[model samples]
Target chain A: MPHDTAAHDTAARDTAARDTALPGAVAPGTAAGPAPVPAAADDGEQSLARLEAGLDALESAAVSDRRPWWRIVLSRLLPPAVALAAIVLVWDVLVWAHVRSGEIMLPGPGDVWNSLVAEWGPSRIGAAVWDSVYRAAIGFTASVLIGTVLGLLIARIAPLRAAVQPLLSGLQNLPSVAWVPIGIIWFGVSPATIYTVVLLGAVPSIAVGLIDGLDRVPPIYLRVGRNLGARGLDSVRFVLIPAALPGYVSGMKQGWAFAWRSLMAAELIAISPQLGPGVGQVMKFAQENLDLPLALGSIIIILIIGIGINQLFFAPLERRLLRTRGLSRS
Target chain B: MTLTIDEAAQARTLTETAVRLTGVTKRFGKQTGTPVLDGIDLAVAPGEFVCLLGASGCGKSTLLNLIAGLDPVSSGSIEVSGGRAALMFQESALFPWLTAAGNIELALRLRGVDKARRRTEAERLLRLVRLEGAAKKRAHELSGGMRQRVALARALAQQAAVLLMDEPFAALDAITRDVLHGELTALWQETGVTVLFVTHNVREAVRLGQRVVMLSSRPGRVAREWRVDIPQPRRIEDADVAELAREITDELHREITRHGRVGVDKGASGHAS
Candidate 1:
């Protein structure tokens, strides 16, 4: 039976090949027009493979090339370092030239550096930084969870989207610091007050970011997903989420900024013993004591933490996402 | 020579049809609106290559969408003997986040292909599309032709009995398009999957399809049909292919001119009033 089937298959293949070779021999509209056999013999297959490989190699050479790690690091670090040095030099020159008003004294860069190292111990500075970072982390994480769910709901449900879209945009535009007064009244100078302020500030922007991302996803991807047997949730998981990722990541970055700023504002205004000493509390203490160098040092620390977190975390993340998708040049 | 419309052929019943659409009509907005596809009755036999040719806005794509089950038909039924029809679009529509192999594997994974088997199966499909080395390349990294080939591989990974393609090669350069046409024909022959390819290009229809069906615009209906008797390895410049393409283009021109004159007459009367 095996031998007979093999012979029959060969005969069928030959007839198909003959039909292709001599097309007019078989009339059109014949449903039984023989199925064309795989015409690629071993030789033909090898040649085709060779041709395709050459084409791929030639074309892929134009694809984005990776710079060496050291080069990338140097490029990223050099310009910012130069700018910082230039600003410091200008500040030092002004102080040397005695450019000052009567009451407010602009501390020299060295004075600020000394305050950073000598006045506050390394452990104290670390603690202050840690406290603020911890609050920001918690607030941002909560905002991400809430924002993602809210965004997905609004994106999927038409009525919910229509109702909430305007309100969401309005909240995003409202300054998060404006919530500080309401939060203090509601929670009374506690961590709850700070967290409430942070949430209100960050959630709107994160949710809006996600909505915009979901909105920007091309209609074609959804059609392709449905056609490939992906039902409702499956479509969301496989197609919608990945396509919206770039936008979502950018949203998370903006949310972190808002969360950090809101936390600082709350800490400066609604301080309590239970809240502990964040960078904002330290800055407020320096202001009360009228210590110019300590105040300058605290401000610098705030700037460093903000820049450091974004540089260390979000920048790399956004870069990686864009690189993988070929959406970025470098 | 004027191509004959094989009316009997259109009505003929095939015992094993991959796709059967009977009186399929689709209207976009209101119930009273003229249908995008007016009573489209098409039956594609297993392993048959059918090209649906028409002018722009003739609803060739709408017909494919209806058959592929991406959109609902207003009045008629579509039955596919296969599990589901896989579709390919003009833009490739590949997920940018995924590599070529990942894209194909996603399709396989969706169809419930086992984890261990998916890798090998994806590799096999890539080879079938002559893209063995492009497994790791993302959609944007590959050339246009390569991306389309990857899209084709991903579609085939569905293991669908019928494949619906809507102007899949319309964006490529002429040389790339020609090369892809040969590859597509070869792939069709090897896989023996039923293809319902929609295109506005007449020569493309004659080059690839076993039968060409023309759709009339302004509520698209099957206006004419022609069986292409050209052999495999037929060129776009071949005498027989050109002859058939000229006849189809002439019919298409007439259809357009007729519509044009009616619009002009309406404008003239409206202006006078």
Candidate 2:
């Protein structure tokens, strides 16, 4: 294909020469002057090539090779595993030292594990996890859709951005859990209340993320895009959005976290027979029943799910995005 | 070949003026303030390599921006015989997300080149810039010189008759800049693209351009113009280039001194000593 294109370029040069009577018609590699120094030019070219090669060799970065899969997995998991073990050990020592009178107040890791095995077995926990995960997925998807539109509107429109940007930041700081009272009043313990709370929590961060990303797109990219004939929506599509991907991805990650937290809060407070069993609902029930082991176990499960989602989904995505742009070391 | 012939014909029919700026003025804010570019008139012929030389604050970059249509002139008209001019900045400005070829390909793709032909065209352009080996390399992975070469290739991929370069080699090291000067000359000769190169370096202007234009600072106006009769493949160290660079540098110093307010006598006498 390159050969074909090279031939085409040569042919074009020939035709350009024959067609144009101007001085520019002089063929490539042939000097424009009558008395041309071919030998000197050749030496110059050789040295130029040599100099360029040396500079490239000296300056061009060597992209480091990735670690082996097992090593990567071990490096990622080992620290957290050790941290969890240390945490459990601390909790056990506290329990042994009579930090609390009984299991109702503070259960040891063993009691929590035993309770988890007896009552919250795989099937029960799986059902609870799926219910919460499903709600979170739906709420987050809606938040993303709404937030993207809102973000684009805010980022592009000056008046809207000026009017709403400060408010959006304030909204991000407001706890999504605080919306539960109003949500219950408005929707009365329905799935809509849960989703509404999740959306309230996630949307602000996503929108703010996109706005920040758009804001940080280097001005040079826009000039280059304009120079390349990218105008209006084409500029945004080809240049602005892609340049802003890192920020947007980070924003979405934060949005997902917010959504997860909001879902848990909503489920914990809005517990009822109508709503199916979820991790948050289980925690609430365990709390009401004064089952410290189940409550602690549920908290651990929530933490695990959050970390798992971030590691398995968002981490890899952000890593790949950064890696491709040569922004990441690993 | 057909594209080149068509462009050449287009240039000829347009009366040999590849780029013309008449009474071009650009101001940043209020109309009361001194304009960055004040009633500047410049004409570049087809396939001419014209270097715009200036001191700092002379708006050398602003002039290129006006020609490239990145910014609107506050007043006056600028015309290009061909379509939009392709621009290269001092910074390579290559998209970090894209590889070297990908950057060129984006230019091609944005120019409405179909997907199937864009890759081949991009590769050919990289080859033209002698960067075939660095095609798959991302912008951050490549050296500064390599990135600039890719930028030049990407500019070429626009296939605009007029190429506006705003101090494109200003950031490169001495040796790399020298090598690129030769490369740019060769590419200009081969492609017959009209170049409006902006630079503050007198030697660079002399080394590359067929015509060197000097602009005075404090509301940049054309101070002087020199038609460089030096032949092609002129080095920065060439006697003719150095001689011309000396003359231009002296003129530039005088132009800069004109704006001096305090310690002018002391500075002049100190320099004389």
Q: Where does model 1 exceed 4 Å of error?
A: A1-58, B1-15, B31-33, B265-273
**Could you tell me every candidate's TM-score relative to the true structure?**
0.88, 0.88
Total clashing residue pairs per candidate?
Answer: 0, 1
Evaluate residue A153 in candidate 2 and report its C-alpha lDDT on the 0 to 100 scale.
98
Residues B1-273 of candidate 1: C-alpha lDDT, one tens digit per residue: 122345444434333688898998999878576778899888888888999999987999988888888888899889886557999999999999899999999999999999999999998787667676678988988888899999999999999989999999999988778778877876786677889999999999999998999999978999999988777656788999999999999998988776787677875645543
Tell me the deviation in Å of residue A93 in model 2. 4.3
Measured with C-alpha atoms, the lDDT of residue A285 in candidate 1 is 84
Best by DockQ: 2
User: Which regions in candidate 2 have their CA more than 4 angstroms from the true location?
Assistant: A1-43, A61-66, A93-104, A121-123, B1-15, B261-273
Give the least accurate 10-residue stretch of model 1 chain A, judged by summed lDDT: A24-33
Among these predictions, the greatest lDDT belongs to 2
The sequence of per-residue lDDT tens digits that candidate 2 reaches over residues A142-229 is: 9999999999999989999999999999999999989989988998989988999999999999999998999999999999999999
The residue pairs in collision within model 2 are A12-B1
Q: Report the lDDT tens digits of candidate 1 across residue range A1-330.
A: 243343345446644754574433221111122333345544333334345555556666765577998998899889999999999999999988888888767889998998888756656767888899998899989999998999889988999999999999898888777877888788888888888889988898889889989999999999998887788789989999999998999998998888888888878888888888898898888889998898889888888888889989998999999988988965
lDDT (C-alpha) at residue B145 in model 2: 88
Q: Which RMSD values do the candidates have, in order?
A: 8.5, 7.5
